[model samples]
Target: MPSEAFDRFMGALRSAPCENPNRIGHAALRALQDSRIPEDALPCPELQREPCALNGVPCEWLRPPGAPLQRALLYIHGGGWSLGTLKTTRLFLAPMVRRIGLNTVSVGYRLMPEHPFPAGLDDCLAAYTALLEQGFAPRDLALMGESAGGNLVLALALRLKDEGLPPPGRLVAMSPVTYADTLEGSHTSLIPLEHILADDSFVVTKAARLYAPHTPPEHPYISPLYGALGGLPPLLITVGTDEILFDDALRFYQKARLSGVDATLLVGDHMVHSWPIFSERFPEAAQAVEQIAQFLQGRTP
Candidate 1:
């Protein structure tokens, strides 16, 4: 049984004119996210947010009072691959920072239709490299993201392995896009009644083409599900049973386990896509945050 608030949020998503990404053009979608409440209005008085740049990519450092200094979290925001910014994800990031009790960096990587595939991926890689250069031991650092950001974190790990760099201690991907190829897995499935805030347009059409216009979607960097998962660090994945990417999460977890990676999957029954990001509105979101915190801290979730 979902909360009343979650039900209302689903209703709102169902009624939203731009709910179907196909109806709105890319520029309009970006403008829509831009039109949300200003950053200052969503106060996280308990946490301090400082804007900074990592390897020239815009990033934000979120620190709670007395946050541990030894370990840190590097976060990537999700918006297909063309939308979102540091401000857009602040709502959930702030609370996550406080709950996790660790300084966190939210990467504002480059977007597509303007930047394209390797550009955003490269920016993420650079951000991780910058963190390493800052002396955060690889084993003490963790990478986390939702949706496309989830894809990027996994891809970044693959890149690290390819470059013979040290792997992060752990990873948490929420409602990630593991299979980049539009035709694969659940991408071809019809949107189920339980699903809301997801559409074929955003994942299967426009964003895919814009982000990987030239490269094949199955490329290890684009869709990490196709990459070798062995030797990666412990992983935690969360997905809504309702979201279109549910199977994507399932398949990735299966492959990861088969590859001998210590992996855990937290499935949210009747939850919407990226539900954790709506901590303020949904109770399940807060619960998910706690579970993530526990997982990141090496406690059983």
Candidate 2:
């Protein structure tokens, strides 16, 4: 059973009218840009944030003073691959940045329905490589993201392996879109009841089509669950049982472990998609962030 707060959250979601699936991303970006939210807001005044470009890709760094300059966690924001921006991602990750106390770089990867497929991936890769060129060794770096961003974390790792680049020290994917086969034709038996109930399949399917257009849905870069998972970094994956991507996280963890990768899966019972990031609304969210902090520091959680 979930708490009263979880119940309230779910109730609100249920009562809220669903946005048009086709316009969700564009609408979100437009509304987000129109809002008055400050771009550099952090949890604490002591924390410093800098906007910079990595290999021509725009990025923001949220840093705790005196933290090692060599270690960084590259964060990718999620918005079904078409929404999300550096300002929004920075705000979303600010609390986590304070808790983790590590220098975190949030990538503002190019969005889709305009930029599309390899463009976002290319920007992420560029940011990562720029970090390497700046003297951060592969073993000291980590990659983290949620939802479509989570998908990118895995996709980027796969791309690195294919390019003969060293894998990062750690990876944390929260409710990633791993199996994109749902974008191919129809929703298959593999999709969970939770997803159907949430009506998230429509958004996911539409977003994927808009982003990948001509690419095969099963392409390892697009649907990482189909890719080989050997020789990657240690992984921590989290998903809510009630989310559409629950199976996505589970299947990926299973395959990764089967291939001898050290992987951990954290399932939030009765929680919705990306619930861990909603720290202020749920106790479960705070706990999840704590676990993430510990995991990133190589401490067993």
Best by lDDT: 1
Off by over 4 Å in 2: 15-21, 24-34, 183-202
Report the C-alpha displacement of residue 258, candidate 2, in angstroms. 0.7
Worst 10 residues of 1 by lDDT: 190-199
Query: What TM-score does structure 2 among the candidates reach?
Result: 0.90
**Tens digits of lDDT, candidate 2, 40-132:** 566667778889999999998899878888899999988788767877666658877887878999998888877889999999999999999
Query: TM-score of model 1 relative to the true fold?
Result: 0.93
- What's each prediction's TM-score? 0.93, 0.90
Clashes of 1: 0
Candidate No. with top TM-score? 1
Candidate 1 lDDT score relative to the true structure = 0.84
lDDT of each: 0.84, 0.82
